[model samples]
Target: MTEPLIELKGVSKSFGSHKVLDNVDLTIYRGEALGIIGPSGTGKSTILRIMAGLLAPDEGEIYVQGVRRDGLIEDGGDPVGIGMVFQQAALFDSLTVEENVGFLLYQNSKLPRSRIRELVKEKLEMVGLPGITNLYPAELSGGMRKRVSFARAIMSNPDNPSETPEVLLYDEPTAGLDPIASTVIEDLIRYLQSAQGVCGTYAVVTHQDSTIRRTSDRLVFLYEGKVQWQGTVSEIDSTEHPLIRQFISGNVHGPIQVAG
Candidate 1:
């Protein structure tokens, strides 16, 4: 296997008295689609936030490209860039699509306005959302908003190409979309991985079955704060691991306890 792009060693997290993650170790390799899945409240999103450096783990270390990070992403830089597409698409309600996607460059980079606009156009087109630069978030449907967020995630500063995200973290990207919309997002996810060089490795946190099966090459099943199972997409069907079977079959009687 390729060297890991991100590694969480002995990671643990908690909210007040409730433990979300417990001494969990996980790795994301270069150029792989990893799916993180489990029952609601099993800490799937918590792990993604830790890996993306958005949240600090209370009891473990995070290494980016094998270099230990001292603090949150705001505190310092990682060896490689990591970007996240939030579950809600997280766009600015007041900004136009172009402004939302190009916000970083506009605020931080020295590039000319024309150049920034050009780059924004490129990214928008890359995500199959062309000519909507003037539209506001309210003008788009749920799926379109998600795609715009994707464009924003992959958006990078040209002066510092190294800052471009090599690993993308997606949190419930297809959550509320219809089946057709979900498939579109799934296809776009795979397309971004295979064709686009910016985001070669990605980890998606999703509950939608099709999103899990179609977007992920390898699967990590989390339950009770630990990785209960790990296997490939194909193995999901043949493996008889109780947790895997229960999850794939949507069975309420297996080892996994259904939440009320």
Candidate 2:
């Protein structure tokens, strides 16, 4: 069998008094779309941060492509091009959408200004937000800003043509949007994962049932800072796992408790 693309072994993280993750072990394979789902604030976002090397676990280790490393994984260039679409869109209000999308290429890539702009425009069109390059983040709707963020995450570095980020990590891509906007983002996620062959592997951290059902082939449930269940999207309904059942049904009377 081929080695997994990413491995989290006995990973644990805490924020002062709050324990955010504990002994979280997850393995993500090549060319697969995986969703991490759970109740709100169950450390789903924190897990993405750890995976992106934004935060380090106090215990355990992170191994990329079966190699143990001290810092973020890097091969030919920048930290393995781990693209993360942040939960809040995280766009720069001062920059135009085009600038924000091509910021990395502008800074590190040897590609000319015109060529970089072309690439950024192409990515924007791919995300279904064509010809909005001149607008600022504040000028667009929430869903549009989120889509621009998606475009940024997938942009490759010209300096390291062979070093494009193989992994795309999304943290709540559909949160805080209306039903229609949420559907658009979910569909885009599926398109990028399945059609474009953009990234070798991608992981989504989300709470929406539609997102999990539509975008991922398999999923893992994170609860109380640890993964409690893992299964295919189809198995989610028939599983006897109490945590998963409560989560999917959004039940308040099960083993899982609603925070007051």
Candidate 3:
């Protein structure tokens, strides 16, 4: 088998005294879409943060392609070449859509202003948000803001021309929109995954069944700070695991306890 594009081995993290991730081991292959689904507060988003270098695991190592990344950001390890679309569409309210999309380009790359604007336009159009570049995040609908954030995340290539990023991390890509808007975002997710080709190796953190079914080539179930089940999309519907079954059926009983 080919070496995994990204690998996490025995990774664990905690906040205060509560363990959020426990000895988690996962590998994302090049050009594959991996979906992560679980109940709320199962550390789904934390996992994405760790992968993006926003958070460091207390144990284990993170390998991007073949290099080990740990505490190297201070010494300039290139910030992991990863893009994160935050759950809340964390766009800058003060900036126009064009500015928000080109924020990174302006900050990191030496590309001229005119060139950045061109790239911003291209990315916005790619996400089906053309002609809204002048709008601010507050001026747009929830779904459009998400798309603008999406455009920002992928604004620049993740890797060197020869070794581009093999993984794209998405956190709750369809969380707040209405059903129809959510579907539109879902389709856009699919489209960008295919169109960019850089995101072949990717992961999404979500609980929406339709998002899981439509976006995941493989699914990993996170529970109680660990992965309880892992399988393809088809397996999700037939799996007999109690947690998986309860989650899919939206039941309040079984092994999953809801805190009051």
* TM-score, every prediction: 0.98, 0.94, 0.94
Tens digits of lDDT, candidate 3, 1-260? 55577788899999999999999998877677889999998899999988887888999898877788875334345323567889999988999999999986678777788888998898898899889989888899999999998888777733334323446789998998899999998898888878854355578999898899988898989999888999999998888999999999999998988877
Report clashes for each candidate as comma-separated counts. Answer: 0, 0, 3
User: In candidate 2, residue 227 scores what lDDT?
Assistant: 93
How far is 163's C-alpha from truth in model 2 (Å)?
3.4
Error of 2 at 104 (Å): 0.8
Model 1, 163-185: lDDT tens per residue?
89999999999999999999999
Give each model's whole-structure lDDT.
Answer: 0.93, 0.85, 0.83
Model 3: runs farther than 4 Å from truth?
72-75, 78-80, 157-165, 196-198
> Per-residue CA lDDT of candidate 2, range 1-260, in tens?
34477788999888998888989999888888899998887888888887777777788988777766465534223334578999999999999999999998888777899999998998998899999999999999999999999999999865675657788999989989999999999989878876553776889998888888888988999888889999999999999999998889888889887999
Model 1 alpha-carbon drift over 4 Å, by segment: none
Residue 35 displacement (Å), model 2: 0.9
Best by lDDT: 1
